[model samples]
Target chain A: MLADQVEKKAPVRRRKEARPQELTTAALSLFVEKGFAATRLDEVAARAGVSKGTLYLYFDSKEALFLAVIREGIVPIIEEGRKLLVAHADDPVRMLREYLFGWWALFGDTELGGVPKLMTSEAQNFPEVAQYYVREVILPGKALMREVLDRGVAKGVFRQTDSELVTHILMAPLLHLALWRHSFAVCCQVPDMDPNAYLESFFDLVLKGLAATPEGGK
Target chain B: MLADQVEKKAPVRRRKEARPQELTTAALSLFVEKGFAATRLDEVAARAGVSKGTLYLYFDSKEALFLAVIREGIVPIIEEGRKLLVAHADDPVRMLREYLFGWWALFGDTELGGVPKLMTSEAQNFPEVAQYYVREVILPGKALMREVLDRGVAKGVFRQTDSELVTHILMAPLLHLALWRHSFAVCCQVPDMDPNAYLESFFDLVLKGLAATPEGGK
Candidate 1:
């Protein structure tokens, strides 16, 4: 009876994640550093410590791999979801502050900064990357902000304004900052080094518009 | 004396505007409709009623010709340069109000609303175009606003602040309007279509920030 009971717990196997999956992760690390155009498959394979053929087993082509990296990398961050409304469910003013801070923190990360500009500058030509960039990154961020704005209106904190247009206005500074960071200021100084403080002024203006007790408001 | 000058000008060798210059003007009408990538040199020559060789006399390459079209075909309106600043130099609040009206009228023309976006997006990779964009287009606009802001602060109608950064914020709404007209609204409808009214809200926010009296501020 003891022998039978001991055998019953045996033969449990934890499946290892596939080698090809590991290769894809390795490819991404190389691509992000050198850029999609400059990165070579051989360099990727070498970096991954895999043969060229083994690398090809995971990604069919460099473009295909680049597309996958953006899709895999950007999607998760945007999908993490925003906490402005949920966290501050009853307070619209606090929620607006939190929302601005949320976007400011996201773009402050240089890794996050590069993706949108890199994708946008190349979007006119590469339809695939453009589609993936918008669907995964832009749409989700818009949705999160839209929810917060809707919450502000419903809470009677913000004016009964057009939520969609206000969402775009709220987004402009961040997107502008991203474009500046990745494109012109890659190794350059931001005019005012602390972007968060600058972004705060923008938030200050927008939130005041949404504020129920707007000072000397129309 | 005027009659004598006219007679002297009429008989002397008249300068011929370059054949390709003439051809480019004709080409622009077609290109605006068909787009640059789709337009052909031969079609441009045909439109100008010139031989392709004659068209080649001024602009040797397609890219050169297209650049010339962008350079010449697009320009600020005559009315745009007739700025009200000189008239209202002593009254900055009036200057700023008048200045904003100028921008509103110019941008509302519909013909010019898309030029800046098209040039920035399409020509960003080209160094010369980007330089021209930064210098001729972006800088002058900023300088004009800066002058107005400086005057406002001096007159105590506006608070003293970083005029350049303040100018950037002032233009943010214009950029937002362009985005809605061109790209952002592609995914969703633009709810607030009245840009002048939108600018009123935006300008009001800025003026409030600069206002000396804060008695009613919450």
Candidate 2:
């Protein structure tokens, strides 16, 4: 009787779990395209092939949906980074490079690339969502970089410097790339930008900058 | 009689010149605060201490006013940078450093700092404005940096690389800083992250990376 009840509930639970993810995914694209104030919940539901009633059942409001989109997108990435950290615990530079490139591959190169652009564009209007994102996503991402920098400094592989500031600096290029792509890239045409080349150059320059070296040796 | 007419005309000409500046200034602040789509021409006129009729006499529409605001803010800075380039033509490195710091002092430290943030947030909604900005402001800014980089390469002070890509890289941090201040700084608070110190660190790392050197050398 217990096994029969468990089997009967499994499909219902699976469908319930999948519905919110589909709604959030649809919402993310719309929000990124139209921005927070302009996007409507009905449109999100329409895009997701669901009724407004269904969307409402999952999310209390558009703000709640926005929060869910951010949370769902970021949490997995942070968990993945944590696993990467453990895997490369002994090599900070390698870990840093892997993490940066891995992030570009997983997030920046995908539809989720809109997240940074969305946050930067809408943060002022939605302070609560912004605060939640900062706490959940930005801070965790920064902390991951900080750990790598700290470990590098401790191991004498990287120069001693303010980890927090360096983390901000390191993240700037990636963030700018995403923001530009989502916002200005529509009209601001640069010939042959090649995102992969851009990231490669960034990694090269940043790692070289962080390398410990004798003063004026070059 | 001629002398009297010329004297009488002088103040009128001055007032004509100043009205547009004042109007643009008001529009810029409002656009920054509320964003382009949300800002009303009436509010902009009221903010500028002018009637709707007077505002319309100067600018045909809000978009026209936005264009004027962008033009008025950036043209002078570009002109100033042009003068700096001429003044520091001989020292590429010094010219680069001075130009970057001077930009921060002039634009980043003023109300004009909001222009970048404004563009990033609203560019998608206003394609024509974004295109004009790219054609007028961004291309010129990139050109200025490219000129500096090309000069450095010619002088053997900097390594041979893609000047365009390098220009984009150099600009990312400054753009990100302005964008952050306008958008996310409220919630993603980092205590003691001095703007000056951040720029200084950026300069240090970037210069180090661009310096032509042997492997493992400073």
Candidate 3:
């Protein structure tokens, strides 16, 4: 019964409906292989073993398909962030560490390749998609982080500054480094950098920034 | 005569050289308009007002042309940064302000609509390009800011820490903000946030990070 629900096949009783997720996964593979702009519904359908009619049943157009792919791709990255940040609830450093590791795991799928390019290239052109990516991924991730930061301030582990801005500062290095890693790792020429320790140093600097001058300390 | 040496097409240049740039720029318009894969060289040549033969005269393939466009687009951003940073040799805060503003200016350009996208997308496929972009543009900008950071540390404007990591930290927010600005501004329904003041607050936080303890305030 659990496996059946999990399978959630286009209920064999009805006109064929492609699973939104399965379509997304298939789209991911095509987008990675051919580049997003070059990918076709037929190609995605063929790869998914569905007809073009079935592919269109799920996504109205290539743009819509790409948007769904991105939304699906990043959702867990945000959701798990919410869960972890809430779970740790007391540890900003630990929360940050989990967030960094989490994003890498989510992006580790090679099929998600075109999504980054999509976010960077076509995002501006399709502001809705860009806005969606930012709203879904960035806003929630930053919000979760801000909550952790606010906790740090309450616990007096962090100095008082506008928590909102501080959150942005804390997150910037890790995300920037990750984005660069995503971009370069494909070419196999990325710097031999470790993402985990980099996050630690990054958090250390954030702590140093929020050290509150230690009363008599600078 | 001095201007002539710099401005004149160098005698060493092959006639084929300039055509590639023209082809790439033409293709960039098509890439931005129709998406990279959707664009054909014939369309690109038409956009550039050259023959199909003319397009082939310069570029061996679409991939080469696309890479050329990416290189051409980002070079100016880097060169402008170099000039701006060089001009503000003495002041780190001032240098940072100029750098952030210059970056926003580049990000706002509609000409290379797909650049950030290409950088991210292609990075997965083209690490060499990503390396070039980071080393040539990002590292140079970091080097410029480092001078100011080192000066600030020496003059008691900042505290002692590894200037390199600090430099990366100082830049993190600006870079993140730039990446998500269009989507973020609209999703959060923000008007363009003032880049200058944002840089000021960002650095103020940074300055606090670098402040020497009263005992260490040598």
Q: Largest lDDT belongs to which candidate?
A: 2
Off by over 4 Å in 1: A1-70, A88-91, A118-136, A153-160, A184-194, A214-218, B1-56, B60-70, B73-101, B104-124, B184-212, B216-218
Query: Candidate 3, B191: how far from true, in Å?
Result: 5.7
lDDT of 1: 0.60
Against the true structure, candidate 2 reaches a TM-score of 0.87
CAPRI tier for the interface of model 1: incorrect
Model 3, B1-218: lDDT tens digits are 35655755435333565667777778876765555656778888887766788777777877777777877776776676677677876776566566666665665435653455455655655556667777766677677768777776777766677666666666667766655553345344644556555655576766666666667565
Better model by TM-score, 2 or 3? 2
Q: Which candidate would rank higher by DockQ, 2 or 3?
A: 2
Number of the top TM-score candidate: 2
State the lDDT of candidate 3 residue by residue for A2-70, as single tens digits.
565575565543334446777788888767655666567788887776678877777788789888888
Which residue pairs overlap in candidate 2's backbone?
none
lDDT of 2 by residue, A94-162 (tens): 888887787878778778888888887777778888888888888889888899998888888888877
Q: Tens-digit lDDT track for model 1 on A87-147?
A: 7867767776776676657543546555554454344445666666666677677777888
Reference-based TM-score of each model: 0.66, 0.87, 0.70
lDDT of each: 0.60, 0.81, 0.65
Q: How would you encode candidate 1's per-residue C-alpha lDDT over B33-61 as one tens digit per residue?
A: 33344458888987877668767777878
DockQ winner: 2
